[model samples]
Target: MTPPPPAEPVAAMVRPASRYRDSKVNRDLLGVMKGTSIGYWALLGLCVLMVHVAGGIWVYQVYKGLGIAGYAHPVFWGAYIVTFVFWVGIAHAGTLISAILFLFRAKWRNSINRSAEAMTVFAVLTAAQFLGIHVGRMWKSYFILPYPNQRGLWINFKSPLMWDTFAISTYATISIVFLFIGLIPDLAIARDRARGFRKGLYAALSLGWQGTTNQWKAHNRTVLHLSGLATPLVLSVHSVVSWDFAVAIVPGWHSTIFAPYFVAGAIFSGFAMVLTVMIPVRRIFRLEAYITDYHFENMSRFILLTSIIVGYAYLAEFWTAWYSGVEAEQSAFWLRAFGPYWISSWVMIIFNGVLPHILWFKKVRTHVPTLFVLSVCINIGMWFERYVIIISGLSREYVPAVWGTFTISWAELGIVGGSFAFFSMFFLIFLKLFPIIAIAEVKEIAIHERAHAEEGAH
Candidate 1:
């Protein structure tokens, strides 16, 4: 019997298979690539303009010097470093959803993993730019690369910063390959549906995906192996990032708990960011045919779980500081609460710790508009978490006289804005070029669903 008609994305999966079909899935997913409204073009143009403006700011700073962007005194790591960590942290949820959940056989990841993987790759790419930005000499930024240079500069093997270079490089390479592999089957679908130049492009990129049984076997094996390979990165990438601060003898950052704290926080922020981008994309592309509230509910639950972990880590930081009775650590924590940047501290606490508890109510979790707002709050709070950890900690350290405030400049704020624009520009470009939802995986799930439906019909 033919499927009746499409329902909600989640409902479509479980509803009598009569309500959906493979044609619907392919039509809906592929439809995203076939249109470009004035609004989307405008948005993309806006992002590009902002990015160029940011580049101009960078150039101006280069001309004047690093001092123009507020890398002064104790607070050497300004907005660029803060944004660097934020992007790196947000990149994790992609691997978590695509890799870790895949390993665990969590089928809920089926619809969302494609977009999450894209986010991961783009977020990490955005983060990589900051290494050069933070160094203030974009030309010499390649020095952070692992290879020995012609100028006789060998990499510093001992530094956690050095570990960051390897972690980012390794993670980005693997993630891009993983994302590309997942896209092949879908590319083949698009190839068959396309014509002219588009046909030729997809034909080449699809790499002869004839969808034979042998090809399916190879694809599944490859995905399973890549899933195994990527799972550890969910934990390791951010842990290595945390080491950049933890290994240092800095008072607020030198805790043993930093790794887990950072990892949990990363997942929390990462999920929120996924929501932030996903909601708009879903609405804009009419993807509600696939990205339904069931997916949103699951993601909210993840946010709720990680929020609790992150909140506990917040309390635990203060507890450990107080228990250790170290003046520097204790004072740093105190100042974080009561010092000049106390507002950022409280924002992190309320937005990250307090607000997400509302997700305990299923109504809130499944509500799309409310989830979008909450996700934005989480991203902002997470940014402040990094800001508090870096700036607030560095601003008031051991010596009273040497400690100076790191006031943000227009250039710094502009670059932060630009980083977001850069990420958005790439993501906008990607939406037109690729299926944001996994077409092949969704069809597989639909087949499983139809099998159960047939059994029930008996």
Candidate 2:
């Protein structure tokens, strides 16, 4: 009897039928939904502190009026406009990744597009903030909008600034919608993994996704359509932003090359910013398996491509000025290259045009430390490029009699630092709340691989 009793039942391994044949994807991505890293908390706290300090500085500037911004006569658009353009350029990489690369069926984008799209939204919001700050009266900022109000004002549809308002808003709306659509299934996965308050939030955001065949079909179709719609915006939005300068009667600002030149520069800097942010994210989050050296190499190739184009643009600017026989254009550019802002011009040329050549070497492109340093250098140079473009042109202009030097005020500098921190803060929160990698897309790659293997066996 004791021997019979000892023959207890062996536990059966009853895995669920609907479960993914490979569950590692879910385990790896969903693991991030729980637990906060100490490093993450430290970084988040630092960003929040920086943001608060920036906010206080902005308040002081607001209270004191535009005088505190260190704006001289003709140099009205100084750091504020430079910072604005820098962020607008920052926003371009996302649209390029999510929309253009998707059209080309670039699978490398799958690992990075989620974060790229989020970056675009945050950058747009940051850039919009400067418009108000630049206006000097945050209260009357609504005047920038095109709406007809009770105060007998007509919308100037012809204004290039208005064009900026339309382009950026539309770009933001589409980007948010595109990001949300992509997030649905990923949120559902997070919802199932999360508990308590986060569970409820994800469940609502995921909209009851059950991974039905019809739901997937709809998602694929919708993504394709939206990708097509977003494709043109990549070029148009930045072209309109360039018009803000090109349409101006400013000497160096008015050039036919401005549109393509600005677009190339935008993507050049945007890709650099992406690399800068993602390299840190990849290291911190342990996403090397997803965001491998392969992805980084491909991104570096783009940096090289855009950099060559940008360098050509630099030479072309001087060429056009010399060839066109326009004294104003020649003078503005001369001042840019050889005048007081020569430091920024050389920094822009050397950092953006010269340094990117290192990416031509496979070893440098694939090397993490070198790539990261190059990215940071590219960012600094891009900032300096805008500085030279705006301040250099505005510094000497056609009338040297009205010329004045624009110093980078502490308030302006603080706000720029804060903008970076602000973007980092939201991105940090996003890492915890959502699946940083697109789980569904990655698993689809696995499923296809398995199916091909099985078919080959058969």
What is candidate 1's CA lDDT for residue 291?
A: 84
State the local distance difference test value for candidate 2.
0.88
The number of the candidate with the highest lDDT is: 1
Name the lDDT value of residue 140 in candidate 1: 78
lDDT of 2 by residue, 263-367 (tens): 999999989998999999888767788889999999999999999999999999999988889898888888888888888999999999999999999999999
Q: For candidate 1, which ten residues in a row score worst on lDDT?
A: 13-22
**Candidate 2 residue pairs in backbone clash:** none
lDDT of 1: 0.91
Question: What lDDT would each prediction earn against the true structure?
Answer: 0.91, 0.88
lDDT of 1 at 382: 99
The superposed Cα distance between candidate 1 and the true structure at residue 142, in angstroms, equals: 2.1
